[model samples]
Target: MRASIESEDRGNSMKEQIKYGDDVLEIELPDDIIVDRVAPASHGGAKACHSLRDDHAEDTYEYLYGKIHQALIHASTRIEKCGKIVIACDDNTRVTPVKQLVPPIIDFADARGIPAEIIIAGGSHRKMTRMEREKKFDKAIMDRVEIMDHEWKEEAVFSNVGTIHAGDESIPLLLNRIACNHDSFLMGIGNIVPHSVAGFSGGYKILLPGLSCEETVRWVHYLISKFPSEAILGIADNPVRRTINSVHQHRKIDLLVNTVLDGSSRVVSLCLGNPITAQAQGASISRRVHGVPVNTPGDIVITDSVPESVDFWVVAKAVTNTKAFTRKGGHLIVFGPCDEGLSPMHGDALKRMGYDAPRNIRSRVKGGDIPREFLLEASHACQVGEVMEHCHLHLVASGLDVDAMASIGLHVITPARASSFVRELIEITRNEVTGRKPRVKIIHRGAEILPLQ
Candidate 1:
């Protein structure tokens, strides 16, 4: 059920059409390039929130609040007398619907006479604007609770917890001072999905990259890059995740509430309990919903980035997820409308450190060539380099110009020119090889799907 060619469309100019958010991209393949398959979109039994709300009207808040209450009571040793609670939530870039979960959580804490505040886990990303904050939270909740943004660059706001020894090198675990010194309980809220680095999103990730200092974020990403095999899409338990969970031993994160959302961003399943335990349960549901099994690797795989894929930093996930299903020296083309360009915050860093091959970048980093300010940039460059080493990557995006694409080691193409460009490239490659047409595969919402081997 992974991919199938439409028998009726075999004779037509259009080979495939995919949904890219609210837009549709129609791909027309030339005679020389044969499309082997077009994968079906993964459906996770997701339903519209309004329908779910109506169906479970009497049980909605009761079911959700019960779970949240049980998790806090079971996980926290001082829930009865806890004074302050910090809820770490995803920012605008993530697909998580923070508004849905925050209101109920605030109500629960207020009833207990515990003061609760929300911190936007911006990580290395830019801070959310006031308008964005207003849109993300309900008016009632915003008026009562203090909403703060995490500032990764502010040194005074971070406190050193301890150091994690990863071989000879030790990584310091510096967290947001408010989060690290929470008077009572800490809760992390996020949606579980396939992640390129930490196997899956959510769990302590809401703490590490979500709330930790810039140095901690850089070290964690670098660690994941060191082990490519384990740190891949659709994976559940990996070294990167293990390292993040290890922090719980030193710093206590009481309760974690992770949800599995469908294509419409409706919650299909909700997990509550220990951070690692809840995340694992949520990931299990995500794998079944998003995992697509492929019989064999394709010579050329084209993916459409959707949802929040408005920047290269966000949309590059399509490249990471599809890398496993792509053959060596093959092509992986991502088509999207990246209106924000590379990234609002990290674009300059990515441009300065060109996407050299991973091996070369690693050598330079080990040799002390990459400055401290560019460490995170180097990690991103390393990931792009690693993907490029395996496949010839291309991007058909409107926001980034040709030079910007080339600067990051991506071949640029436009929606109008894609057909001819693909045909020409395939024809040349076919002639050099056995003159056999390249086997192509198309994935709709590629960033959201997890291709399983």
Candidate 2:
């Protein structure tokens, strides 16, 4: 839920309830902090993300379901004879409405006496636990189908599909064994949103980096680091996107389901058709819906990583999305309720490396000081490091080590009380004159919201 909130002066401070994941949190700002504005997860004109909720949810759902059903009907010849199908879906990191949208395909298959299994497109992220899976899909759907996840570490499970470029270097493009099965129909599912690496999320992403082998995942991420994020973030078809679309040449997926969600996590619109065309169609609406106008960059920008996520990895997204609004040499406050702690899969690699600028990391990797094994982690570092170049980042969250993050250029701060962290943070970062107030902007759903100047 988005927060229809405005900052209110409360004597010596200001208080406002902004979107904190699926809930709202009352953030008390010190008197010295000026709340210049607040942006939200889903946004367009009216104010923030909360104001964009589509109250006619039932109509929207029925409409999208019917649309998807129609597409499935056309593919009946193959779907009916196949006996089994594979459903590709994004992991929990995305707020995709999998529970609501996925069932249509499953039901279609079941009615035709066909079985369906779900493959979690985890990318290089860790496996989604049963609890996360439940949250990601319909509870009942879990019992009816076998759910599997992409294993980036297991070389044996992947089949070398073809070759894709990381830069000038050509790398082996590998996909899962099941994904290689051309006999069954594969339905790729995800929501479209602005993204730094892929231009926009969904489409070919749910297949290439989503279920690709370790080498493919690193190649995709590494290719993106070579471009400035501003060029890719919300662009319909950038170079990064064009390169990713190349994967479709190898894998012949029958259909793709890409939906656009409002700030309230309700369906705004959905595109169901060829993966490339559908993603392009959905991204157009996504750009229009998610693009929030920014008056000016803020002296202090506050962004949040919602609860129960992949820790700093999720926080890195919040940082990437919100960094554009932080004036150079300004402060960027990261509000992360990281229940999963620092990346469970890449924590060791992260701890060993610092959040150096992208060029520095690039130079070290080129010098062969940093090995190729941590290529994906290197990509993560470069994304986060890009933000550090423009602002002084202060990470305020749980499930993180203070000294560990501090050593990597992240100034970690935690309050004795959760409610006091923001206020205490303001006091500690008082770089201005004693009587001066600093301008602040709060990006409620920092990981998904896009700010347009």
Candidate 3:
């Protein structure tokens, strides 16, 4: 039988409620016990390694899951018989969502006679195909964690009470059903960002996608990630901010631990305990350490140290950097650090454009009607050699065929010689042209050419 809630500290409680974004959870504990769980977004790489260490010192020498295991151990150690513990985490195969990290934790928790239920938190969110879910979260966690039925539940919302102000808008937070509660410390482990909702990141959000249903998740994602330019993943005023506010109201999760990332997405600093306070402290460090803006563009420009991800896809991200600033044909110099190959979409597009790539790319403008054979022929037309011959292409590559570029009658330079060549080109252009030197553009890491006028 389910237990009913009763308040104990009626006289001493100041305000009976508080706000998180748009939602408000109770100020007084509904029961004598309560537990809040938050699992943050995971971007695998070096940053995660550093982030793990900084947040939990005892587990600093331990790997990512080591701390997670400790949290489980702590929760299990404290909760008595019938006392509840809720764990929210990503479906990542390696470190979370219980199956991978829990067997040991669960076995430990179970041994202590504490029963636990796992809940999938996505509600009305798009459901992951079973296969997709299985691949991401191993069967072990899937089996033990109680997957919340996202489809049938009433919409989750925050109570209207105290609100956080963002510009002119005021978001409301509301109380929701009690999932689990305990007197032990409330723990939140994850990364933080300037989200569209929940003001700064780190808090109630870890559970939505981490535990929610696929359709519920998909629906929310569609809204949050809608306009790419208007809403970056970690930017403000995006749908996520509103949603975050709507669900987590005045929960006052005890501890929020996170990492600030660097340019290579490395974790340069760590923030722990109390998101309201910790987020403010970490934001400063993030800006100073990893927030270098792209350089201002000039006419004929060369970009150095561009991310290799630029060439990985047909949709080049360079347009976002300086495509508008660059003048057509006016030489955009690219520096390469790419040992990895180009994006398949990009390769396919090149092939369809008559470049000699293996895959046939269908034209987006033609609505996939262009035959594959035609695409192959077009692929042949835009070969690297042909592009160099027709357009004023200057290539500086480490392992690329520089001689082939020279044979095609275009300027070619080895990686080492590029700086001098650029310097000479600048000198020659400045001498020929009168009024201020024509802008010379240089891109450090060149992958794909963004055709921006």
lDDT of each: 0.72, 0.75, 0.37
Candidate 1 C-alpha lDDT tens digits along 1-453? 122332122333565675554577676676545565434333333332122222434343455656666666564457655678888888877767666667667776787787888888878888887776777776677898998989998899998999875434588988898788747578888888788777888888888888888888888877755766424566787777888887787677777777777655656667776788778877777776667676566677878876557788888887777776678888888887777888888888777777888778888888888676677777777777788999889887778898767765777787777666666766666665574556677766577667777
Clashing pairs in 2: none
Candidate 3, run of 10 with poorest lDDT = 31-40
* Segments of candidate 3 deviating more than 4 angstroms: 1-61, 69-78, 90-108, 121-124, 149-153, 156-189, 193-200, 207-249, 254-272, 278-290, 297-453
Global Cα lDDT for candidate 3? 0.37
Candidate 1: give the clashing pairs: none
Off by over 4 Å in 1: 1-9, 19-22, 30-66, 69-77, 229-231, 423-437
How close is every model to the real structure, measured as TM-score? Answer: 0.87, 0.89, 0.40
**CA lDDT, candidate 3, residue 374:** 35
Ranking by lDDT: 2, 1, 3
Q: Write model 2 residue lDDT over 1-453, tens digit each, in one string.
A: 342324433247666565444446677777745675554444322111123344543465566677788889998998877667899888888888887777788888889888899999888888888898887886899988989988878998898888776567787889888878887788898988778888788898888888888777876787767876787787888877887888887886788888877665657667787889878877777766667766667777877664224588777887888788888888888777565666888888878777899999888888887678777788889888898888888776656778877877777766334457666556665665366566678776677777776
- In candidate 3, what are the lDDT values of residues 142-244, reduced to their tens digit? 6865543333233453222344433343433322233324343334445443332222344455544333333333344334222332233234334555555
Between candidates 2 and 3, the one scoring higher on lDDT is 2
Each prediction's total of clashing residue pairs, residues at least 3 apart in sequence or on different chains, is: 0, 0, 76
Model 2 local distance difference test score: 0.75
